[model samples]
Target chain A: MNGVHDMGGMDGFGRIEPERDEPVFHAPWEGRVMAMMRAMGCVGGWNLDMFRNARESQPPSFYLTASYYKSWEKTLETLLLERGLVMEEEIVASRSFSGSTVAGQPLRAEDVSKALKRQSYERSTSAAALFKVGDGVRTRNIHLPTHTRLPRYARGRRGTIERVHGCHVFPDSSAVGAGDDPQWLYTVVFDGSELWGTDDDPSLKVSVEAFEPYLEAL
Target chain B: MTLRVRALETVLLEKGLIDPAVLDLIVEAYETRIGPRNGAKVVARAWLDPDFKRALLEDATAAVSSLGHVGEIGDHLIAVENLPTLHNMVVCTLCSCYPTDLLGLPPVWYKSAPYRSRVVRNARGVLAEFGVNLPPEMEIRVWDSTAETRFLVLPMRPAGTEGFDVDALASLVTRDSMIGTGLPKLPEVGP
Candidate 1:
């Protein structure tokens, strides 16, 4: 989705102005939202890709104005509403819906650490690794409204494979309720000049993890 | 926002989807247990011991996990070391994907538009604003972290600390330094 979150090149936002010794959550609500998201994630209502897509699919204007966790809360609402976990009227009334269908297992307090560490994405398909380190590849110029790990700025650009990360969960298919569709993931390095043209400093380069489907022989 | 979050929590609680106790546990984990100190310790150990550094460089997950610091966004971390010729920094151009287990939640600026959008093309400029003015000849590499695999920048240690131990060295490793936005703290004033 071409949402405000795909902010890779366009400018006009002010200085980064990072806080000194930043906390995990600025306000207490942010932590609650994170906890809620974690608990909801355990409910198996949707995959992480779906949660990402839901946030990315938000109105650009609203997404821009909203804070980070605010966006998460909004996405949580959308997911719950879409999955029939809660009703719209109930949300408006601050009341719990009686017919909510949250039947999946809850992330119990004791299981929080385990749940956080679990990595369920890796799998080996009969498919062998396509590109090796140092192989030249180009990111497939793609623009889709659904979901993609490929950034808009890196699209159609040429890069050299830095490392073969082996097969991992493919986000494109996973976002739409499809299987992991394990694909070869590569850390491809592109010269900044290749991405931003001659104006960019030659000393600059960017590396992105491009799945097999997002690449083609350059 | 709190009202909305509270409402949602109420819904989930009432629906029996989640327990309030679990929410508090998650919050506490992010708040105290996980933080930049974790990454700092890793970086300090790497600086102190060459074998661990090589292990971290070869397979970050196993090396990091051996330290009992496993999970969260550190699920599949790739620790990129900053060297004299090559400088490494991380950003999530698409979204703010970070190794929360190692570095805790990212600073707000990392998720902002300026840092996310400009770092790819204008890393020097971005670094300049962060007070990191790299030499023109040194190459800069910006890493884009994804949900499955997050990247952490193992900032090079500063000179003049010949006798510093891991604990002392870790103090020099700030959060921004590990992110490649700011340099590690300078040597303390001589006694």
Candidate 2:
């Protein structure tokens, strides 16, 4: 099984193979939905279960502000049409879902699903936290996610107490619906020799914050 | 302020699930409303008082709140003083935990993985990046702020500034100096 240190390989820091190119974006409506949820104190409150259930089961979900989504939906539809990723008829059909009926249109679920998946993947992989404050720990030398803050040169190194930043929500695989959970975070301070090996400058030190799960106390 | 969240918003938009404009409004609200301004006052106070400086090294949050800047984290804070013999630097290895009640918003570089990962591993090197070159004999104590405790650095008083009042001294204590990047220096007075 791959470990944290293996991330360098995916990003060409080591010998692991990289994944194929993938770009992701979100549907214009999702932002509005999340905002409205947040305004009701539903995003980070006890109502998480309610929201999650709603997200999974509800259709015609409430949007935060219709005006915000209106312009973005137009832009996204235009882009999809321009890229030939969606047919003119499909755009009209999607618009009709928002209650805007266009002339002579039909929709294909496959095309819309593919576009949504791509956008989701992009959002999920872009999260960067690998550590946090006050964690006594080390970095693993593996890669599995889309983006990481841990560097190739500092993997497997030891470090000490730093800060404990509050949970900022996990973006990595979670953004892509891979089940990565949000974690308490910390930053570890490592000595130069530990990260760079002997002959490295003795005076140097590096500090990086990773999630609680990313570290094992040393 | 909104830069980081906007980046998140962009990702959501790219996913074709969320609208960028809505994310923008949410981010704007967070940046302006829920932002941490209390931290700036403590940082400002640290620059001005000597006794407070002493108090800060002994206990950070209290010393800060004594000057009227309490934080949302840590019920009690432990301030690690940076002396000529021992130098202390703060970082949030897990995320971006900081003594925001004193320092205000963490600089962008502080939030970057490079600073967070590298600072603890090679503290001296990281300090150098901030233009702080520590002597070899001096022991560097890197404080990892996890859990409930928050930390701030009480830098040594600058030379050539003896007898300066608290307000005058505080002006010299810039955010960079407090972070250990630069030392407070006396501003040249007009002739």
Q: Candidate 1 lDDT, tens digit per residue, A1-218?
A: 66778888888987777777667788889999988888888884699899999999999888888889988889988998898788888877777859556556678877888766546577778988888999999999998878888998989999999988878999999999897889988899999989989987999989898999999987
Quantify all predictions' global Cα lDDT against the true fold. 0.85, 0.47
Error of 2 at A49 (Å): 16
Best by TM-score: 1
What are the runs in model 1 whose C-alpha is more than 4 Å off?
A118-120, B69-74
| Span of ten consecutive residues with least summed lDDT in model 1 chain A | A97-106
lDDT at position B51, candidate 1:
96
Task: Report the C-alpha lDDT of model 2 over B1-191, residue by residue, as the tens digit.
Answer: 13323433343333343444444555343334323334334544555666776787666645655663242333335565667787777765544556543454455455444555555556676676666677887877666543335565666667766666655666666665656545555566658
Error of 2 at A52 (Å): 18
lDDT of 1: 0.85
Q: Is the docking of candidate 2 incorrect, acceptable, medium or high quality?
A: incorrect
lDDT comparing candidate 2 with the true structure: 0.47
Tell how far residue B189 is off in model 2, in angstroms. 5.4
